[model samples]
Target: MSSSAPNAVLSVSGIGKTYAQPVLSNIDLTLLRGEVLALTGENGAGKSTLSKIIGGLVTPTTGQMLFNGRAYTPGSRTQAEELGIRMVMQELNLLPTLSVAENLFLDNLPSHGGWISRKQLRSAAIEAMAQVGLDAIDPDTLVGELGIGHQQMVEIARNLIGDCHVLILDEPTAMLTAREVEMLFDQISRLQARGVAIIYISHRLEELARVAQRIAVLRDGNLVCVEPMANYNSEQLVNLMVGRELGEHMDMGVRTIGAPALTVKGLSRADKVLDVSFEVRAGEIFGISGLIGAGRTELLRLIYGADIADSGTVALGSPAKVADIRSPVDAVRHGIALITEDRKGEGLLLTQSISANIALGNMPAISSAGLVNGRDESALAQRQIDAMRIRSSSPDQLVCELSGGNQQKVVIGRWLERDCAVLLFDEPTRGIDVGAKFDIYALLGELTRQGKALVVVSSDLRELMLICDRIGVLSAGRLIETFERDSWTQDELLAAAFAGYQKRDALLHEAAPRNTL
Candidate 1:
């Protein structure tokens, strides 16, 4: 295959995909060298399906895919890799037991006549790691030992090891820190300089505006629009993706906040969580912000009884009661709900239907006299889907088939349906794109307005700054400081979160009893 023109690395015309039903129809897309094309859509909006078709992970049920003006049909991932097309999926695909260098050089190890060249493999892995700005990670380090951000870098290095012409990244920054995200953008720019056609898929519209040359939107299994990034603002992009104006109506209206709904005093969890104390008032958005591994997630798990806290007191004001909740079921019965950080692992039954996942939270409410009430369950699921504006083919569709944003919504809907008063959300908007993020934020506001106290734990400083009224900063498993919305800046919050631990210790000492000292 050869190209007459200098541009147009890959082209797709009338690309249609179908499984049990139509997943995409008449989708047209073009990837040009030195340019980034962002694919945006809501959950189950056919973005992943389209990407799969391009990467040869899945063949389109209809339409044609062309590379450099030649008919291109990929029978397997190997074929695509050979053709200079590589895709990094949302879910990582690294062998955890393997060393980082081994994983990077798995496909193309330097060899000497049936013998592997260890030195060559290590050198090549180092070069690839450097390309992605991950120089600190030793090639000999185990893949499982690295954080999610480092794992992502390894995936990128794997793609770069190939003669990649078209690079596709799906939700790559979902688990990254601010510094890591900047590094990724720098590497992406370098790739663009090398004339590699990049297809970037993310829920964050702001990122697309910064890095992407153009943006394409998909809805209901159809290509809705494709235009320059400059042509669309955040609001316009969201409207196009969702096919409706997302308004402030999702706000949980203003309500009178009562006494503290939940109070955690002297919470500790081994090395991950130190003595942490905080209070979430009814109808308030109490947010927890810190860098990754700052103990925010462990603290949430302790509150929800997912992980045991060495010692802590949780007091609920509703009926003015306090009790020891040592398990998830106990927390649920006590009007508490937890939306975990790892949605795929903890929040969803990927193989089950949306209805099943939604109904799983409160089974007794949907059941009747030792018999499951199918009609009532269906009705309840339908109501949540409508309320949350979850985009799905049907309530019966498997959750695994939906996009990242939609999956998050399903998890949230599960808790919302149970009418939980104290909701703890961990990275609630982690993998969700920008437009969907706004919807979730609005939904959080609505929850607070309804007198439901929310404690949101997030790595996104901007997200915490925008949605939370009061933010708590944690470091080394300890609560270092607290900031009101007006008093906190991004830099200040970051500093307090990472460097204020000593100050917190001093404060704790001053507050302790003289007899104990």
Candidate 2:
């Protein structure tokens, strides 16, 4: 499809981008009105670059874009939006300090005589929030206080506010719950009905088949395939994305299970995390499965001392001696490491070079007498880059310039330098690609082989099943149940995840007074 096509809402020809080197090249694609186009590829394959070009976040080195048959050149995101072209990027574009209502209507505030109309803003925000299943949340609540999943929904809602001719969603459901994802799909259907052109970008192949009418696959900066989505299966799509057939079964290698290396007893933190307790053995990967508000991330934060536990004890080693962990520094000193879910916000210093980011925590080895050893710092980063297969020009490349999956690799690479006995990974592969996910899985297996206990929290139950020795389900801030790999089923895990919430709801119902007329 080209710009000349009658129904084409947007089209790009000879689209290419280069930064230090060519990241995208010679891409020709068209978006039809009221049709969903699925754009997918491995990380660094130029999916984001192409979307950014179309969305006006980045300028293409060589190319031309046509919007409804007219030449379109967007110099800034504001310019693009003004022309009814909007995008919800993978990296959130939100003001943390602002209230949800304020962020949603920041560009076009409802005002009268230079005064903001609080009533109008709240009403509009509530209507938008309800579309994404955020009706229960107060519009005046600060965005920073909401979980990553909620924040992602807020970003989506903001884009859907005004007249939107073209909407590009880049990994929109990465942090969303299954229910939240359903809500998003429902909204997508409504948008389709309204004749909105959508470019849905995601690594989740199943999602592409579900939502997109046509599929466009990119590989190594080149457009490889553009066909009806039904023509290819998930496995076939994966093969196209990575340029190789990936086996269904993973090779975790041989490893021996050992004694309990990390133990949490009676962990509680107000209503968010309630009396959560578990033990992770050396040479074992303990997986945490839960819904978005089920307190999975909060539990991990408590264990890592990112947040203090109101009442709990964290212990390390065979005999289970309690460790006093009040902060991240204390946790690190005690040989505990946490790979946070919000990689951009919490994990990496985006402006810094890859070498500098990797050398952040491992300064002791890379520095001498307060003077940093440049050779040692570079070597430390180079070792992990090679190990993690991080795609970059060199160690000096800034983390912000790298792709999302590659940036995640740098975050993992930083922790690999430390010989932490217990590692906690919170949505480690949240926005990563399939091939890179396997790489991290292999790394986890290696850690287990080294007798390091690993705790992985993931929204994907299949992911937990694939890499975990035992899976523990968190429900309404409680550890509902823990099942061995062979003993657990998907349905069983999901039931356990909702068990706490169900019980709580039942109790609340019984406590409420009933009026009889």
Candidate 3:
């Protein structure tokens, strides 16, 4: 009765997709029950498109798919879910306005006599949250109140609630903390024990070796390789993912450092950024590293005047201290630009044309007598498209149609067109591919070479170590320490990042009296 390959849980053959061009072509892959397949590729290499086809989000141009040795073509997400197939997409689908308990069991909330059972919901939520190390969070708390990393965990927990045989996790740990990642790994192990087939998509090479039994490398819409994880070392995996050898890090040659380009002092925000202070030198890259909810993003928001700081002083340029940045306009006028962390919300206008979006932050430059020059805007967009190497059919294309990486490039391209003296990048490479990431790195180096100061915030510790001349650690809203490139080690950085939370726990124990300290 089975039409699929023997013992295969899911099978895809001759799958192809075309957009402005052929994004994916003649693809074939199979998933086996109780096995983990690590799916990896550069951005826009058709990994997400292929995942979308399997998840019933996007119809493939041409392909045949089978699940459990039977013809399986899901018409919609609901159909796939009904067939015991689920996907945790990179862009979360949860309603942020709802409570954790509500979002987790939204599809099948407990009800009796036409009344919702809050008591049962709390119990179920606690159990599910505990699985992902979110036990301490209140179930009734709104998901909007959670940070990005916490929200990611909530998304994963929601997926695990139902009967699932095949699950596709796209960039599952991209925003997770170290501890949260460990909890996720544990959950994956349990799922494997229960005979679940998992297709794990991630950019972190080390994580694949830990969770995936087999690795499948996709490049340029083709199945480049599928081999045992042990068969491919980290370097070899990178080679396959990008179809070339990539160095561990790019070396930015030595340069003369100028006076401080931007200086921040006494930066404080209620319960988010506390007494943060730092100075970024001209032609140098400074990095900030910390755990999720450790105030890294909040600190950048404060400096850029996106969020009001309770107490702070921001001075731009060497020896010429200027007015405080009370608004984003003030920050911009002072030659400060912030590439925000949320590309979907803060960084882009997805519904607008790519040319229009790029003209957003550069209106003053692109406009003539208060009216934007259409020809100039198109030319500007075209210049950036070439410089950023964005893959797009035309400047008239909507931003939403492009991949995440291309959209990010548009954001950076906007600032590059400006004459900003200091650039603040928040999680700049969050979901960028290795190739695109290196390009951004080279761009950063080029920016610094032009004497522009750069402040970069990233969750990847290795990335911070490699790119920044100096790095600062933010732990629980406090700037714990800063270290030169030669001084910072992974262990030391992690220790500094986790120090605040450890001290807070110790203080609570001492105050509790039962656990006297």
Candidate 4:
């Protein structure tokens, strides 16, 4: 007796999971040969858990799966790899100590006797890297030397190596440039032609619509919808994922922009940032957009005093004057708060309780005569949490257990609890779902309403366009142009984003001279 579904490469039935709480329940999905199925939902919605289970990284508490029309349960990631299942996790899996060649062929290094074949390694590495459009990177380069985007490419290349029946890519384009993303889509097409089953998970909804043939939406551990990607518009898909009606577009709300609240003049740091000057007004949402490595983050770090500037002035206030921001402590003393891109590293104390993490930043305010006021601290946490709408069981819950979006909210909430007059956000909505992103945008709106100045740096061009009153495009560490909300178009902004990367001086020098705050 043979199964009727001959083309089904993977079939999951009654799949469920639990970890200190019920995460997933009664989920079913199918991956046919040569088709791209997208799984999307808010963070902690069990999408990652499902993909992890399929990749043998986590054990499902309840479920049965059939692979190639047979009962399949992999004991480990290695076992899954042996069975031709691969997962490219959002957090990169490459070893920094190893060379790109070594990381690519870590499990099965080519060797004769006991001696590794460097020649053969480079040859094989180049081919695989080229497959993923990484032809420029030398095979012998250390993985640590590469930037985040290039590292992501290496991870993808590693997964595409040998015997890949099923490939699961989690937020694959999160760090990639627009050009690299197109390259990835091309590779996906090539793989599909060879009958590979691909599962793509991304927070960027538009990418899913473009690349996936079918979409499976999961929300709060339950499968909400599964259908051809063609059937659902962006709004419908977002509605299914977050269980709410949301417009796919954002309009500039009426907000009064006032005197300069934060100002940087001639900001320069080695070659990472150069002669950058800008002013962000009170109640103004100023956005900075650029390609990766274009000095946006470096510039923010300089203003926040996370990094030192060679020669520049940073100021904060309604009537701004140069403030000596020699360190983050100095910056904080002048009412400046920076929500870093690396949330897990610089933003949150993950192992601590949510209340404690939020309370950590404002100890002086929460303390009475140096003795901790437990009640005031808890109240403070609850206040910001409510305002931010951070989803958590209670303030007592550990920050580590919450989703990416919630963790981000906690970081922002901590800063919000302070008396900061200026907030600088770097990739503020990175790893956040569409619904949560809107929530953040709304939160930003509220902050501006309170007359707190904001400087946001983002890789997402449209996100900046949606939220910012003014948008500045940085090129090769230079503030090439800054455009007012009424003065910019999407195509113009996109052209400016790639200005530094366009391989010509004409593009590098283009744009309106600059905009006054």
The lDDT for every candidate, in the order shown, is 0.83, 0.92, 0.88, 0.87
Model 2 CA lDDT for position 175: 95
- Highest TM-score among the candidates is held by which one? 2
TM-score of 2: 0.98
Error of 1 at 426 (Å): 1.4
TM-score, candidate number 3:
0.95
Candidate 1 pairs with clashing backbones: 203-433, 203-434, 204-434, 251-446, 252-445, 252-446, 253-449, 274-477
My TM-score estimates for the predictions, one after another, are: 0.85, 0.98, 0.95, 0.90
lDDT of 1 by residue, 1-517 (tens): 1234469889898889878778899887777888999988877687778888899899888888788778999998889999999998887789889999999988877899979888888888889898877876789999977755678779878988868899998888887776678888998998999999999988776788899999988888888788898998878887887787775333345567777888888899897888898888998889897766678877888888888888877878754466689998899888899998667657899999999999999688899887778888788888888877777878888998887678889998887756788999988887775556776787888787778899998878878887787999888687889998689888889887767566667888999897974
Q: Residue-wise lDDT of candidate 4 within 129-226, one digit each (tens)? A: 99988888899999987766788899999999999999999988877768789999999999999999999999888899999999998888999888
Clash pairs detected, candidate 4? none
Misplaced by over 4 Å in model 2 are: none
Model 2: residue 292 alpha-carbon error in angstroms: 0.2
Order by TM-score, highest first = 2, 3, 4, 1
lDDT, model 4, position 75? 92
Predictions: Cα RMSD each: 5.5, 1.2, 2.2, 5.1
